[model samples]
Target: MILEAAMLHVKEGMEGEFEAAFRKASHIISSMKGYIDHECHKCIEAEGKYLLLVKWETLEDHTVGFRQSQKYQEWKRLLHHFYDPFPTVEHFKKVAKG
Candidate 1:
């Protein structure tokens, strides 16, 4: 499995807006091929920040399949503006688990 992580820094006072946008955007991603699951968590220590964790079968499923799909365009349109500084996404493979 591939894990994608992003630390989203939403604009001040736009947490609700960001969540609403993410709700819509997530649907687009979830409908795509190779999508496993995802979770979004609001940061209690840092207001307006969120952590997005997504699981995929492979990195290509995200970097190529999902991002190149038409839904990604809509996802970007809906959610891109909410970020003050764009988040960096990272991919990881499970090293160990209990």
Candidate 2:
């Protein structure tokens, strides 16, 4: 599996609405082809910061499959507005596991 990670920063005072919209957006991603699992965590020390980890069956599954699909438009609409400067997303393959 490949992992996609991003540090999300929700707009100030919109964390609640962002979370709600994210919950709705989550379904859109999970239904995509090659999607394995995902997690969204809020940072304790940072009010508007969050960590997003998503597992996909392969890199193309995300980079091409999902991103190219119309579902991505809905995903963008659901969550993109919350970001200020926008988050950087990176993909990684497993190297070592304990």
Top candidate, metric TM-score? 2
Per-residue alpha-carbon lDDT of candidate 2 for residues 1-98, written as tens digits (9 for 90 to 100): 99999999998999999999999999999999999999999999999999999999999999999999999999999999999879999999999999
The reply for model 1, stretches above 4 Å from the true place, is none
RMSD of each: 0.7, 0.5
Lowest lDDT 10-mer window, candidate 2?
Answer: 76-85
Residue lDDT tens for model 1, 2-94:
999999999999889889889878888898899999999999999999999999999999999998988889989999999979999999999
Model 2 C-alpha lDDT versus the unseen true structure: 0.97
Cα-based lDDT for every prediction:
0.93, 0.97
Give the CA lDDT, 0 to 100, for residue 61 in model 2: 97
- Cα-based TM-score, every candidate: 0.97, 0.98
Residue 19 Cα positional deviation in candidate 1, in Å, after optimal superposition: 0.8
